[model samples]
Target: MDTNTLMRTLDGTLTCTTLYGHKYRSAITGQDRMPMALEGLTRGKSLWIDSLVHFTCPLTPQQETQHLSRTPVPGSVCLHTPEETVTLHERGADVSFSEHDVPEDSFLSYRPRLLMAVTNITITANEWQHTEEWQLDLEEI
Candidate 1:
């Protein structure tokens, strides 16, 4: 589906298990510590979610140029209503990683390892939002 429609479908929050390690360590990626569990979120166009969830975040004007870097495992983010689970990386899927830094005083960076990175996530319009963004609680298939 188109970017606009995908954003509208995933207009709420999402949680991911693949993101836990990202919260405790550095975003620049030198410190490879143990993986931890992180529940990330995304919204209309104001907030930036975690690395694992950013591929489904809403698009901004400038991110149109950012590229979809290769994902080795490219974990999944699940949405509901159709009982759908969105795979963050598919061949030729349009995911952008252009970032907008969160100000030091902004609440977005109030946590331990919070970083405001804007990524545009586009998915099919047929899906619907889930009430709770708790993908972390799901067991491995």
Candidate 2:
């Protein structure tokens, strides 16, 4: 399948390009903070939550070029799609923090109001397989 056709098959394809930020908390690492006590040490060992967003779609050559030109930059704004949220929910995902109050059900309209940065963008083309796909990876800023 070509990239454009593959995109048409997806429920939602992200088109918006606006970057936003959200507050995230992580323990002060040993390099940054000295443990006050055994409890503090134990608590510090707890894993930190670094939200990640990944999605794949087919893009036109122009779109692919645009993405290649825009991504992996510190200033680039992120884009998202409702299908991404729905998929995450289906997979039992949770938002540890949210800019808006998340209801127990039906946040299909909710677009995460969190700041994210593009970490990587990958384009794969296989002529024999007749497949071209764009993979976007984002990490919490």
Candidate 3:
């Protein structure tokens, strides 16, 4: 699992183990190719590899949502990646809603039935956030 799917422990330390795809899949696509093993601090040094039985690993996606540091409310939308772009779609009235009737991002554009009378909207960028990974290596720190 990547950092996006990883959860940190109480002391701001991350615990993870390499998965060979037996009990739980390693990567998101289920292809186990982790370059490093579990990390731990013992005595005073940082340890990389640990016994398989002693390693801390990420849980499956389903299991993760349950115990997430920010647990998702039932029926809420969950974006797995920061780069993931989501478009607005109005689910039917039959859509199961939890504490909210509509998703936060979709609320402004949401229509009760299906369609709306909105004509136009202007898009503006207020801030320039971090760039993608491929652009990083090309720039000098």
Candidate 4:
């Protein structure tokens, strides 16, 4: 099956779970929800969906490193590092992470150092299936 082509067809809004224990709604394009294309399909009669999901959040260095390290989710993988990207593949899904790449000391000094992060998730399901990505953000309020 053409994973890239199928990914382009599957697109929609997806729910994101955060490591801090919160859920938010984000806008997804055809390329973002590509995983949906595999809905109700099997390996013998199913196709692979290649979709990507992006997320942005404001967080501190301490929060980003500590909270994320202790997170207890198996689906979401940490692409820890400033301006770094990581790829994840699981449950017929492909995931990626992107960050602004900031230094710890610099991040701490920056007022309201809001970290902007993006996650590119790709997955394939036998049936129309939906998955969530959780991120934990810490604040010094």
Candidate number with greatest TM-score: 2
Which pairs clash (backbone N, Cα, C closer than 3 Å) in model 2? 20-115, 21-115, 22-115
lDDT: worst 10-residue window of model 4 = 106-115
Local distance difference test values of all predictions, in order: 0.27, 0.31, 0.26, 0.31
- Model 3 regions more than 4 Å off: 1-111, 130-141
Winner on lDDT (1 vs 4): 4
Q: Write down the lDDT that model 3 would get.
A: 0.26
Please give the distance, in angstroms, between residue 116's alpha carbon in candidate 4 and its true position after superposition. Answer: 26
| Local accuracy of candidate 4 as per-residue lDDT tens digits, 1-141 | 421222222466443432463333232333333334434433233112211333323444534332221212234443434555443322212222223343453221111112222233334333344443323222211
Model 2 over residues 52-140: C-alpha lDDT tens digits?
33223332222211122112222222223333342222111222123323333322212222334444444556666665555444444
- After superposition, which runs of candidate 2 have C-alpha atoms over 4 Å from their true positions? 1-109
Superposed by TM-score, candidate 2 places the C-alpha of residue 119 at a distance from the truth, in angstroms, of 0.8
Quote the positional error of residue 109 for candidate 3 in Å: 20
Which residue pairs does candidate 3 place in steric collision? Answer: none
For model 1, how does the per-residue alpha-carbon lDDT over 1-141 read when each residue is reduced to its tens digit? 322222322657553334333322212221123232233523222332233423323334333222333232233321111233333332232333223332222111011113333233322222243222222211111
| Per-residue lDDT over 27-90 for candidate 3, one digit per residue giving the tens place of the 0 to 100 score | 1111123322213412223212211221212323222222222212233323322234223222
Task: Tell me the alpha-carbon RMSD of every candidate.
Answer: 21.0, 20.6, 22.1, 18.1
After TM-score superposition, the amount by which residue 15's alpha carbon in candidate 4 deviates from its true location, in angstroms, is 24
lDDT of 3 at 29: 14
For model 4, what is the C-alpha lDDT against the true structure? 0.31
